[model samples]
Target: MPHVQPAAPAPAPPVAAVVVLAAGQGTRMRSSRPKVLHALGGRSMLGHVLAAAAPLGAGATVVVVGSGRDQVEQHLAQIAPTAVPVLQEEQLGSGHAAAVALAAVPDIEGAVLIVNGDSPLLTTRTLDALVAAHDAAGSVFTVLTAEVDDPTGLGRIVRDERGAPQAIIEERDATAEQRAIREVNAGVYVAAAGTLRRVLAGLATDNAQGEQYLTDALAPLVAAGAPTAAVVAEDPDDVLGCNDRRELAARRRTLNDRVLDELMRSGVTVVDPATTWVDVTVSVGPDAVLRPGTQLEGVTSIGAAAEVGPDTTLVDTEVGEGASVVRSHCLGAVIGPESTVGPFSYLRPGTRLAGDAKVGAFVEAKNVEVGEGSKVPHLSYVGDATIGRGANIGAATVFVNYDGVTKHRTTIGDHVRVGSDTMLVAPVTVGDGAYTAAGSVITSDVPPGAMAVARAPQRNVAGWVRRRRSGTPAAEAAAAAESRTAAPREDRSEPSRADSDS
Candidate 1:
C-alpha cells in the first residue's frame, strides 16, 4: 500500500492592518446621525465591523471619519479604544477615504484589509477566509466579490477571458456589457500596502461621479502586471450594506436571525425566532428558553434552565439558574437562582433578588434587595429598602422611601408580614416576626414580635346619607330601610275567631 502523505498545512494568514472606511455622508439615509452610527442588533454598525475585524489580530486599525466626526470619534473611543481615527476633511469618495486611513499608519507594510464600516453583517469567518485566500494566491490586490440576482446600483467586476478579475467598474462608468454582469464588488479588499499606496496616489476623478473611484485602481494594478484576484463570498448577505432605513431594517432582521439560529443550535430554545431578538453580546446558557417578544440586549446573560420572555426586555441584567422572568422590563438588575419576576414588573438599577425570591405582577423595585424566600407581590413600589428572608410584602404596599427632600431607607426583618394598603414610611423598621395592619401608615419602628397599627378608630354617623344626600339613590335606599325597621307587626287572634265562625 502506498503511504499517503498528509497535505501540507495551508500557510498561516499574514498579519495585516485593517482600514475601515466610514467617511460617507450617507445622505440617502436622511438622518442627522452618521450612517455607521445606526444600530443593528443592539450595536452600532461601526462597532460590529470593528468586532469582526478584531479577531484578525491586525497590526493596526484605522477608521476614516468625515461627517459627524465628533460623534463617530467619540463612539470609536468607547467601542474600540485602540483603533486610530483619522479625519477626512471632505467627502470626496471611498478612494479618498482609504488614502486618508493609510496615511495615519504610514509605517504599516504587508497585507492590509480595507472594509466598509456600514456592512454590519460581515462576520469574522468571512473576513478570515478572505485573508487566507489573498495569502494563498499571493495577490498584490484582491477584491471580495459576490454574485447577486440584481446588480443594480452596485459596482460590477470585469473579468477577463481567463476568468481573472481585470477591474471593478462603478455603475455610473460601466458600459452595457459590464452593467449586465451579476458579479459585483463587495467594497472589501486585501492589498499589499505598497501597491495600495501607489494606486491611491494616482486615483483620477474623470468618471461620471467626478470623485476618485477606488474601483479605478483595479484596472491599473492589473495592467501593471501585479497579480490580482477576486474571492467570491460564500454568503452574499455577508457583504450587504445599509444605505437607508429600509435596508437597515432588513440587515437587522438578517443579523438577528443569525444570532438566534446559533443559540438554538447550542441547546438554547427559541420559541419564536421571528419575534425574539438577541444581541450579539448576549449569552444564554444551555437548556434556557427564550419565548416570543424577548429582547435581550447589552451584555444580558441567562443561566441554565432559565426561562425568559413573552414580552420581556432585559438590558445589562443577569439571571441566575432556574430563574424565570416574564413580561417584565429589567435593567442593570440581578436575579438569583430559582427567583421569579414579572408579568408587569419593572426592576430598575441596583435591584437584587436572592434565591426563591419573587417580584410579582405590577411590582416596581429599585435600589432594593429582597432576601431569600422574600416576596414583593402585586401592586407594590419598593425602593431604597432591604427585606429580610421569608418576608411577605402584601398587595398595594409602598415603602415610602422619599421624603420632601432626601430619600431614606426602610428595613424589614425576617418573617415580617406587611398587610395590604400598608405604607411603611421611610426611616422606619419592622423587626423580626412583626406585622403591619392593613390600611396602616406606619411612621415608627415596631419591636420584635409586635404588631403596628396606625390608623384612626372607626366611628359611624347614622342616617347621614339620607340627611346630606337627599333625592340620591343611596339616600332613597337608606330611607326605605329605616321605614321597614319602624313599621309594627299585625295581630292574628281576631283572624282565628272569624275563621272558626265561618
Candidate 2:
C-alpha cells in the first residue's frame, strides 16, 4: 500500500471550440446584406449567436463568412473581437464551411461545437446541456436534434431500431419513410476534435445538390465504430433558423417576447409588454416601469424606480434612479436621478443632465452637460453647451454653436435667465445672475448680474400714422398751405354751432 501511489485526478478537459457557419448567400432574403447581418431585436443574427456562445468561454471561436466579409468583420471587431473570422470564398456547402473553420484551429484537442449563425434563439443552457450529454455518453459525435411536428425544410434524423441516431437525411434526399420521421436535425453538432477534421476531410460532394453536406459526416462517423448519439432539444422553437425576411421577423418577435418576459419577472413593471421592445443587451433595474411602445436598445441601462415612455426609444443611454422619460428619443446620453425628459425631445450623444433637470417638449440637446436644477423648457436647441445649476432656458432659445467655418460652445452660468426667442451666438457666455432680453441675439458675453439687449432702439414719427391713413399726403399738405395763407390775410372764423353739431 505504501509503494502504490494514488493516481492524480484526471486533468479537466480543455474547453470546446466553436465553429459558426455563416456564409450562405441567402438569396431568398432578397436583400444586398449578408443573411447573418440581418437584424432581430436590435441586433444582427450573428450578434445574437455570438452572445449565446460567449458563456462557453470556448478555447477558440471561428466565424466562417463569405458574401459580405468586410461588413461582418467590421461589426465583429466591435462586438466579438476575441472570435476569429475565416473566409470561405465560394458558396459551396456547410461541410466546406466547417472545413474552412476547422482549418484555423487544427490543433484543438477538445470537442468542436458547430452551430449555425442564423439560429439566434439558441440558449447557452441548452448548449451546455448538449455538451454534458455528449460527455456523459462518451460519444465521438453528437447531434443536436428536435422533435418537430412538421419537419419540412429541416433534415430528418434517421434512427436505428434501438432509437440511436444513425444519420441525417435532407428533405430533398429523404425517402417517404424518412420523411415521416418527426425528429429533425437542428444543424448543430459536437464532435471530438480529431474525428471532425478527419470526417470533414473525407466528406464528398456527391449529393443531389452537388455540394458537400455536413450531415454526410454523421453516417461515416457511425459506421466507423465511433460512438454517436443525438440530444433532443426540449423546445423545437429554440432551434429555429432564419433564411428570409419572414423568418427574420418571426424570430424577432420571439426574441422580443423573451426579453420582455425576463424584464417583467425581475421586478420591472411592464405596462404593455406586447408593444415594448427591450434588446437582449439592455438592463433595467428593479422597480422600473416600461410603458407601451418603449424600445430600449444597444446596452442601455435604466436605474431603479425609473419611468420610461408611453412611446420612447433609448439607445445606449444611462438613466438614473427615479427618472421619468416620456415620449423622448435619447441616444448615448446620461440622465440623472429625478430628471424629467420630454413629452417630445431628442437628446443626442454626449448629453448629460444632472438631477432635477427638465428637458421639455420639442427640445433637442446635443453634447451638452446640464447641471442640477436646470431646465430647457420647450422648443429649444441646446447643443455644444454647458448649463450651470438653477439655470432657466426659455422657450425658442437656441445655442447657435456652429458657424460656416467651425463649431463652438456656449456656456450658461448659475441662475442665468435665457429669455424666449433668444439666440446665444457661439463662443458666448452668460455669466451667473445675468439676464438676456427676450428676442435678443447675443453675440458677446454678459457679465455677472448684467442685462444684455441686442435690438434696434425705438423711433417715433409724429404724423406718420395719420398721413398713411389719409392716403393723399400731397393734397393734405396743399390744403394746409392755403389755410395758412388765408389766415394771415383775414380773420379765421370758427364753424357755426349747427355745422359743428352736424
Candidate 3:
C-alpha cells in the first residue's frame, strides 16, 4: 500500500472568525437603542456589518452586543441565524468587547477580523483585500490605516524610523511629533487568532478611564519582532464608527451612496441617488431608470428598461421589463412587461398584472389578476377581481366586490368593453366579448357578446324649463325640492308685483 501520509491532518479547515465590536452605548447616537441597532439604508447598521464578514467564509462569526442586548440579539437573530451571539454586559472598552466576543471563537489557527459594528460602509472586497495582503506578506496581524488631514480624535499610527511597526498611540498618549503624523488608525483589523488571544489576555487598564484597551497590545506585537504592518485604506469612512446622531446620518448617507454607486456602476440609471433609498438585497436590472425620490426596498426586483418615478415606492414588488411606474406606490405585487402604472396609483398587496396592462391614474387594485392588454383607465377600484385579455375598462369603473361583511369577486371576460362609471357587482361574471353601457349598475351575469344596460330610461318633457319660469316647471322643481313650504298657502293664479319683477 502507498503511504497515505496520515490523511494530511484533514486540511486544517481554514478557521476564521469575525469579532464585531458593538457593546458601546454610543452616547452620541442619543437613542435608547444601541448605535449598532440604528437603521441605515433600511436594515440595522450591525446587519450590514455582519453581512460584510459572514460572506467571507468565516467559520465562526461573533457579534458583541451590549447596552441594548435584547433588541440587538433580536435583530441579530434574523441577520445572522447561524453565527454565535455574545453578550458583553459590562460595556467595557472596544478591546474588552472583542475579548468577550472572542470567548465563543473556537481554538483555531486563522485570522480574526475585528471591525466596528456601526461601520455600514465596509465592503467585502476591501476586507478580502486586507486579508490577502496579510497572507501574502505572511504577517500575523494587519491593521487598516488611513492618512487623513485632521486626525483630530482618531488614534495615530506610530511607526519607528526604520518604517517597521512600532505602536498605535491614542491622541492623548501621542507625543506632539507623533500627533503630527497624518496616518490614523482605522478601527478595522485582521490578526492571527493566537496572537489576538494572547494580546487580549495581556491587556491592562492604565489609561485615564482605567479600562482594558486593545490599542495597548499593538506595541508588544511590534516589540516581539512579529511581522506587523498597516494596510492603508482608500476611503476613511470604511472604518468610521457612528458615535452621534449627525454622524449616524452621515454614515447612512455614505453607505446608501456606496450601494447606489455600485448599482450605477453595474448599469442602473439613477437620476438622483442622493434622494433614493435602496436596500442591500434589492436587485435592479440594467437600463432601469430610477428617478428622484424613488425608494426601492425589501427585496424588490426592477426589470430592465423600466422607468420608476420621481415619487414612487416599491416594496417587495417585482416589475417586469419595459414596465413604467410613475409616481406610484406598489407593494407586494408583480407587474408585467410593457405595463404602465399611474402617475398616481396604488397597487396594493397580492396584485398581478399580465403583459401590456395599463393601471391608470387614481386607480387602486388589490388581490386582482389583470390579463394582457387590459386597461383600468381612471378613478377605478378593482378589488378582488379578475379580468381577461383585451378588456377595455372606461373611466370611473369600479368593481364593487364587497358588501359590508363579506368580500366577493368580479370576473370580466376577454374583449369586453366596459363603459364609464359602471359598477360591476361581485360574485358575477361577464361572458366573453360582453359590453356594459355607461353609468350602468351591473348585478346579474351577461352572456357572451351581450350588452348590459341597467340605468333608468331618460324622460324628456318639452318646454319644461319655460313652464317652470311660468310656474309649471317651478311646480316640477317644487315636487323635487325637499322644502315645499306648502306653496306659501297663496293662490297660483294671482300674478301681482312679483310677476312684474319677473
Candidate 4:
C-alpha cells in the first residue's frame, strides 16, 4: 500500500462571541464622563477596544454597559452599529458581567472571548494567539497572563508543580507568597461557552469584595478535571488597562508612538515623532512628510508627496498629492494638488482650493472655492466667495459676506484682478478680465475688461492741517512745507527773447 499521510485536523471554528465588560464607575478617573469613553488618538477608549476586536470576525459582539449607559450606548451605536449593548444594571463583578453578556447571545456556542472595555492597548494579535492556544490544547478555559514588573493590585496566577496554571488568586485574598508572584492575570479569557455558562452560575460572592469574581471559575473547572490553560502575552503592555488620568496619558503616548513608528516603516516621514500626533483613523500615503507640531485627526488623509506642518492641524480634511500646508489650521476642507496654504491661515469648513492655488500668510477663508492658479495672498478674509482661474485677490482684501442678518456670496470671473485694500461687498460679481482699482469698495457688478473705482476723487484742502492743529508736530511740518512752497524761486527757466536781445 502506498504511504498515506493522515489529513491535518480541521481549524477551530471562529469565536462564537466577544463580550466586552464596561460596567465600572471608574471613580478614580474623577470625571463625570464614563472612563471607557475617555479618548486617546482621536477615538474613545471603548472605540479602540472595539476596533481591536473587530478583525476577529466573531459571530457577535456584546458590550455590557452600566454607568453612563446612555452616552456609552450612543457612542457604541456610532462606532460599532452591529455590536449589541447589554446593560449590566448593577455594579456586579466581572463574572456577572460576562454572564449578562452571554445571556444576550443565548444561542452562541463554541468559544467566547471576554475582554475589558478599558484595555484600549489590547491587540487583536494577542487575542488570536490565546484563542488558538485554547483550541490546540482543547482546554475548557484559558486565561491570558502577563509578567509585569509590579503586579501590585492585580490577581496573581498560581501554577502547579508542573508549571501549569492551577488557579488565580486576587490580591486581596492572596497569601503573602502568592502576592509576591509577578505573573498576573490580564482579565482576558477564552472559554467554552457551555462550560463558562455552567461555571458562572455557581460563582460565589464570598470574597473580600463580596462580588462574584471571574477568576473563581478556574478553580471549579480545574477541580472538575476539565482541562484549563494560560497564554502569556508577548508584550505585557498589550494588557495594560486605564484607571486614572495619569495612566491614560501614558497609554496615549505609547499608542501615538506605535502609530508613528508604523507610519515611518511604511514610507511616511515623521520629522519629530515626539511632537507629531496622528489619529488611527487618519491615512497618509507613502512619501508624505509630517513635520513637527503636526496633528492629523478625524478621518483626515494626506496624499503622496504632500508636506504638512511645522505647526499645522487638520481635521476631517483631505490634502491632495504634492500639496503643502504649513502653520495652518484646517477643518472639513480640501486642499487640491500642488496647492499651498499658510505660514498662518485658517481654512474653515467647505473651503476648497483647486490645483496650484495659494492662500498665503494671515489669510482666513470659509466656504470659499479658489479656482486653479488663483491666489488670495496675505492679509485677507474671504468667505462665501468663488474665485475664478488665474485671478489675483490683492493684499488686505475682504469679502464682506455677512451683513449681521444673512450671509451672501461674491463671484469673480476669469483672470480678474482685485486691487489692494479692496472690499468686495457680497452679492456682487466682477466680470471676466475686469479690474478693481486700489482702495475701492465694490458693491455693484463690473463689466468685462472695465475698472471699477468706487472711491471718491482726490481732493486737496490747502493749509488745512496747519489750521486744524497749530501747535502739533504735524502742523509744524505742514507750515514748513507751505513756507517753502510760497517762497519765490530763483529763475531756473531760460530768459525770454527780448531779454536775450538786450
Q: Which candidate is the best by lDDT?
A: 4
lDDT of 4 at 265: 96
**Better-scoring candidate (lDDT), 3 or 4:** 4
**lDDT (Cα, tens digit) per residue for candidate 1, span 434-495:** 99999999999999899899999999999899789999999989899999999896676576
Ordering by TM-score: 1, 4, 2, 3
RMSD of each: 5.5, 6.6, 6.9, 5.2
Considering TM-score, which of the candidate structures 1 and 2 is the better prediction for this target?
1
* Model 2 local distance difference test score: 0.91
Off by over 4 Å in 1: 1-13, 484-502
What local lDDT score does residue 81 receive in model 2, on the 0 to 100 scale? 95
Model 1 poorest ten-residue lDDT run = 9-18
Q: Itemize residue pairs with steric clashes in candidate 2.
A: none
**Clashes within 3 Å, all models in order:** 0, 0, 4, 0
lDDT of 2 by residue, 248-321 (tens): 88999999989988888889999998889998889999999999999999989999999999999999999999
Clashing residue pairs in candidate 1 (N, C-alpha, C atoms within 3 angstroms): none
Give the lDDT of residue 194 in candidate 1: 90
lDDT of model 4 at residue 394? 95
- What is the lDDT, from 0 to 100, of the residue 415 in candidate 4? 98
The residue pairs found clashing in candidate 3 are 28-244, 467-473, 468-473, 468-474
**Taking the tens digit of each residue's C-alpha lDDT, what string does model 4 give over 187-236?**
99999999999999999998767788899999999888999999999999
Candidate 3 or 2, higher lDDT: 2
Please report how far candidate 4 places residue 38 from its true position, in Å: 0.6
